[model samples]
Target chain A: MIRSVFFVSDGTGITAETLGHTLLTQFEQVSFQQMSLPFVNTDDKVEWAVQRINRAAESDGVKPLVFSTLIDSQLRTHLVKCNGVVFDFFETFTGAMEKELGVTAQRVAGRSHGMGNVRAYSERIDALHYAIQNDDGATTRDYPMADVVVMGVSRAGKTPTCMYLALTYGVRAANYPLADDDFERGSLPAVLEPYRHKLFGLTVDPERLHQIRKERRRDSRYASMEQCLMEVRAVERLFKRERIPFFNITQRSIEEISAQLMQQAGLTRRI
Target chain B: MIRSVFFVSDGTGITAETLGHTLLTQFEQVSFQQMSLPFVNTDDKVEWAVQRINRAAESDGVKPLVFSTLIDSQLRTHLVKCNGVVFDFFETFTGAMEKELGVTAQRVAGRSHGMGNVRAYSERIDALHYAIQNDDGATTRDYPMADVVVMGVSRAGKTPTCMYLALTYGVRAANYPLADDDFERGSLPAVLEPYRHKLFGLTVDPERLHQIRKERRRDSRYASMEQCLMEVRAVERLFKRERIPFFNITQRSIEEISAQLMQQAGLTRRI
Candidate 1:
């Protein structure tokens, strides 16, 4: 049977969604129709949200599963009154924490995503600007400042990986696309010599790389299977020869790639 | 007391980190030293991770808080054996889901981030490409195809917001920077007139805008507080005149900003 899952929150619903998705992934046999109901802070909004949940439960012939991060007691009480198996995140842990720490929670909404620390926000923005400025090996003006320099063939998932690293970890990630000459020479690029120790590489299966390239440039020589195979082999060979750590991202997500990079490279997150 | 908090996982540790942080945020009065330990999948790794956690417990003179998502039962057992208050994510909900759904979980690491759905990956990549190509109003070749077009003054958080929307939600978000001329004209740009329905505006406090621009270009007219106030007031007036919904992202995180944009614009996530 298809289950209806609701991620309800007083703010962005990110915490609810993340925790709910993690829980749902364990139920491999059950399919879920997930919906995010963010910013349900007021009495009227909470009441409206409850009606939606009840409707879902009635239509699906089963109680909907609700994962909530509602910090307000009144709003959370309203949500629990709905016809669903409610997993109240704040409610689950706040009481225990209050007892342990001998203090009460602030019970504020959007505290996690609001202006908790201005310095942290500025640092993240600076890292993002660094990633943008150094994307695709466009500039090496401040290569020494980068936390990690990602190297990969075109369409081997360098740019998005760099962006993800920067945005999520406050990592100053610079990415360089390996060109034909670097592959032909079977060596690292001259410009990357200074930052060799900070390099991380990504390689993909030839078929996947070929498909990705084909989508970017339809039916071109660069998108051909032969070119993809050659590029992948050369890049892997270069990584091995240079003793640079690399990963095949053909079956991995950006989260996996970034986590592996941080662990393998001993990169510290700035924020 | 400053407690030690560990987010341990067999895969990327993202879920552990996200949920642990969310829970910890409620305890505002307590101090925490947080660390993420990912890819602890094997017996040896689990042993090493547990030892590390034990060390932290000893150093802190109290039990560490361990939030884990290890799928393997053996590794989880080992982790719980450590000197910490371990909250096992998978163990907590897996049995309940299995009982409810009448099936065993797949018990796999990195499934959430693996290449499970190729179409989703492709859509995300395409959205990223669109965000890059349309960033800062460089090109509006396919504005009609955009899910949302973000507009703001330079350094008002357009590029990073669009990128977050694209990466996180697979939304084809395009951003345009409002030039001085546009503010002077007191109207939307001629090129953006046809796509007004897709427009979403972002603004920032004059002080915040001044600080951001000062970082980008120090000791310039653009970074002056007077100039920042003038620009912000003009842009806000134009938005009000046009009845365009806008947000002041001076204190909002990218997560909150993206969620607000999606809700306000009624944009559908492509993925």
Candidate 2:
């Protein structure tokens, strides 16, 4: 039987996986199960979660370990009634934060630990970049289901994120490149017409583009600052003309980009 | 330019990338040139790290985001000399532990974090299983790198992991079925012999195996508890005799296994 049950905040199952994973490495003898309860702040949901935690603890030969981060008292009491060891962040941080912050967490942040959500956003962005690098643009005809298709000059992080959506969140992501000819012609590729509902453009600062391009080629025509700026301007106009949502990669990290894209595309975690 | 430097640690650079990518998501105006120094805990590498960090902070007009688990001092001091923000766990934990545990971390643990050569162990076990699952055993030639290979018996959590790794890691992780015949044969498939290094395996509890397989194939030879127990016994013996160091997948969550396999394969943050 597994020895521990780890409950994390809503949408942070992956973060719990990463942290719980490290903790599990230290204690090799025990098994762990992840219980992801999103939006546990509400009174009704917290009560339901408490019942589940109690059942998991009492159902077996030995009471299991409950390692949790439940912020609500409704959930905390249910946890207290359970017949096992309960290691909770709420227990650890509640009194401390109450003393230090001068106001309770409820008065400040709603069931905090959005840090995990931020981490998941990073994982999705990593996947997006991975997807972009792997997109063989020649054959990317008619793959559906990306809430948004991120188009940018080469080396802009796009495909990794699409794959992140597919790999981490089961979102189908397809990427198209803005080739030199397409840039010169000032247009997206022909095949992107049908999926225009999900098209977005990414452009970076010309100087950074120059540096990134310099890594692959030394002073090539495409890597030239003038050429990069020209392309960036063209791409921006295309995004404006085509009315596709677009963002500058210069001032934003992938997480910021992914969140904005998710918001623009009306996407959220399935959980 | 930013004022802080950040360091994230993984047993290897994988954890570094995971967190580094996440931490960068916070600000839109922030731009930090991300650098990852792999295998930096050794003594000689410290000065070189310090030089680079200082150079970045001063010359690049950007605070360095150094994602490292530099357990060794010579390397960390390199950054210590620089005037930037340095946030690192290896520094945090080891420094805390040195004061709290009353012993130097180097004395407490030989190294800070690693799946402690688990990649090597996983690969060794996985190699034989990969050999067993090959359908093209009839062919007579040098084995091509496996298009797909997986290790783990039924209900062993190998299938989902294999699929995830294949789909996400872009690794074709083909899992082998470990029935009595495969075990009794006393050797992996001939096709796998050529690609032995590419084999991988997963192991789990017999009762769990029965419960999982029961749902899919009831009243069959494969689903029988007795059969599951016998096959597990035989395959384990075979693994022992073959000198394959295996992991007990029964207790491990999928992310841990996938992370371990990716680390074992040296495929962290490749894109």
Candidate 3:
């Protein structure tokens, strides 16, 4: 049966989406049509949102599940009557927190993920620029300033890892593509010598790497299984020889890759 | 006084971080030192994590705050004994969710942000590749396939918006930079004409755009306040004239920008 789920929030709705998705994943049997309704702050907006949720409930003959983080009581009251199973995330926990800590919440929207701190925003933007500027070994001029440099064979999950680290943690991450030249020489690139300490390697299963490469450029030497195996083998050998920490991304997600990399590298998130 | 906050989880700890930070932000009176400890599944790891929390509590002279998403009973028991005020996330809501949904949780870690579905993982990776290939007015080769195309002047937050849409929602988002050449002509670029329906504009405050540009290229005419104002005004006029939805990114986070764009574009996340 198809079910409807709404992540309703007065701000970005990211927290509602993240938590709601996590909770929904537990019920693997149910197929959910999920949508996010962000910036639902006003009475008029909440009334409109309620009608939308109620319509979904009527059409499905089941109450749509709403996971909400709206802090305003008036807006929340409107949601409670939306003919849906409302999960009041902020109200549920914030009450307990106030009682436990003996301090009331400020009850403001967007404080969690807003532009509250200009410095933090700039740090993230700076990290984003760093990730783009140094992408795929484009430049090594600022290697010394990089928090970490990820090296991997093409399409082996390097670029996204760097981007995730930069965007999520405000970490200055750069990634380099471990090309055929490096594999042929059986050594690290000369440019990476000075910043060897900042190096983190990524290796993927040869079969998976082949699958990924085939998507980008079909029926080429780059997408061949033999080439994938050779590059992965060379990278692993170099990682072992240099004692640089590395990971295999064949079965891991970007979050897992970045978390493990940060742990292994002892790089605390700048944010 | 400095207080330490720990985001402890069985998975990547992102959920804990997001929720915990939201709670902490309410208490603006205190300064927090935040750290994430992900993949805390084993009893040994939990024990070690407890020690770290205790050390932080000892050093800070104020009980540390532990925001945990550990689903395992054994881990939760260990965490309760730690020298901190524990906020158990899963325990707080999972029982209620179980009763409401009539399904017991599987208690799986990393399901929220993991490689649970191979198809979803491949989709995300594929979209990411598409975004990188079609970034910054790079090409019109695959414009027909893009879920959305973000257009704006340089440093108007086009690249990250495309990347976020791609990475988070598995939307094949391409970005085109609306350069001085496109503006002086007083119309849309020739490449973007066919994909006008997929276009979303990002406009930043001229001052912020100037600051951002100055960082990229200091002391250049491109970074001047006059140049920034001229470009922003022209882009805004174009957005209005063409009836393309647009946003000002001066005070919004990337999360905010992406969520609003998804809403405006009516783009359902592919994942």
Candidate 4:
């Protein structure tokens, strides 16, 4: 049985630790641990980690499973003497991104985590996720309670992102829908008008929306490819006319999107 | 075979979707999907959920496996007609808590996840699992970018709780030893001094600490009952003179401790 697991990251160990903790919840028997060597992008940290692993092997007889997000291979080699298994997140993701984006990611500048600001994107994305899943009509009552609200059409990943916000930030998030009918009428949804400043928008390509919707409703008009295209164009136009600041969520993971919004919204880096 | 799974809490479909998506990250073949009924909490939402489940069953021609968390039993029965196995967390936990705490729980709260604040707690503890396993010092500069340090004798759950804080709040946490030698010195390890306000103390009864420590290190003076009492006494006196707000993490899980600490420190929640 796995007694322990470690999460390592090349940058901040933030993503690795979060995902690691999440995975550990499924099992009750194992203990979880984390250590981040932020500049693990360096040879020094890698050698240091390997030395620690060597010492652990000498004393702590237990085998530990290491999950890492190091973008460098040399550091991983340093940990070779550690008496356990090692896993990397940036390793797999870089390969995937290289294949998909058709280019290697340039070493980022001065640690953005792909971000320039903190709370703005954090708070907004959190609010957006909150809005998408506000099923109890709770969003209506949540206005005063809300730090932000996100509005958009179907399959825009409103709910999941919002929940991430609420779960992560303790920010009360409320999302509103800009349905086909509402779009046709050409204005923000009635529920959203009163909270315009708090109302953020999410947009995605129609192709993506249709593909997601198709998984649920096979032949329905809402799920059809052509209709999805029409909806996207309509929603995009509506958001533009309304001057709502929106994001194209095609390339971003839920994390990146929320992070970006938090930066945009001026929320501090509580992350 | 299970094609997909749904993990939901209360009326928000988005929160369930966030969990479902994260769970999906752990698997390669299962099709992870999500649905929500955010406005319907109390008894009404349960029946509505059952109707939706039934409809999904008809469309998929498979009994959908639902990991749901609806607190109302009357509504849970409605889901029984759906041709799938439904797992409700509250259904299990409420009974367990009622038995353990000797009281009934009222009001279904956020995401209605049976984990609730424990959800945050689990996330933190899980991070600790990763920390020990990985152990590269550079983690200090990573996403958690933790500067605050926690120090106490072992088995006080310093590792797990730090991971929880790091992953949950993005606090880069580092812990140092407060062993006999350090105690004799009557001062914190030199490295922890620069981050004093960020320094939070975690102190528990030595007897309890000894019992827990014994599981990891057998028969050592550090793990003996008498020694534990001495250390506990010394640390309490040290903390009082030095003035560190600490919690006795004797009986509580990492989550309970984390919740108290987060509230105490006035730290903002991290998604």
Best by DockQ: 3
For candidate 3, state the interface root-mean-square deviation in angstroms to 1 decimal. 1.2
CA lDDT scores, all candidates in order = 0.87, 0.53, 0.87, 0.56
Error of 2 at B84 (Å): 38
Clashes of 4: 50
Which runs of model 4 end up more than 4 angstroms from their true locations? A1-139, A269-271, B1-271
Report the CA-based lDDT of candidate 1 relative to the real structure: 0.87
Which is superior by lDDT, 1 or 2? 1
Q: Is candidate 2 or candidate 3 better by lDDT?
A: 3
Task: After the best TM-score superposition of candidate 1, give how far the Cα of residue B73 lies from its true spot, in angstroms.
Answer: 2.1
Per-prediction TM-score: 0.96, 0.40, 0.97, 0.34
Candidate 1 DockQ, CA atoms: 0.70
Candidate 2 lDDT tens digits, A1-271: 5654544433333333343343434444444554544345455765676667767766655555554555455556665566655555335434542342233444222212232353453344334333443354635543563455668777665644454354444344566778678766776677788778877777778887787688668879978888878877777888898888877755443333454455456665431
Q: Write the per-residue lDDT of candidate 1 for residues B184-237, one digit (tens) a residue.
A: 888988999899988889999999899888988999999999999999999899
For model 4, how does the per-residue alpha-carbon lDDT over B189-235 read when each residue is reduced to its tens digit?
A: 56555666766778888776776678658898768898888888888
Residue B65 of model 4 has an lDDT of 55
- Badly placed stretches (over 4 Å) of model 2 are A1-90, A93-142, A218-227, B1-253, B259-271
Ranking 3 against 4 by TM-score, winner: 3
Give the count of colliding residue pairs in each prediction.
0, 32, 0, 50
When sorted by DockQ, best at the front, the candidate numbers are 3, 1, 2, 4
- TM-score of the candidate numbered 1? 0.96
A76: Cα error in model 2, Å: 15
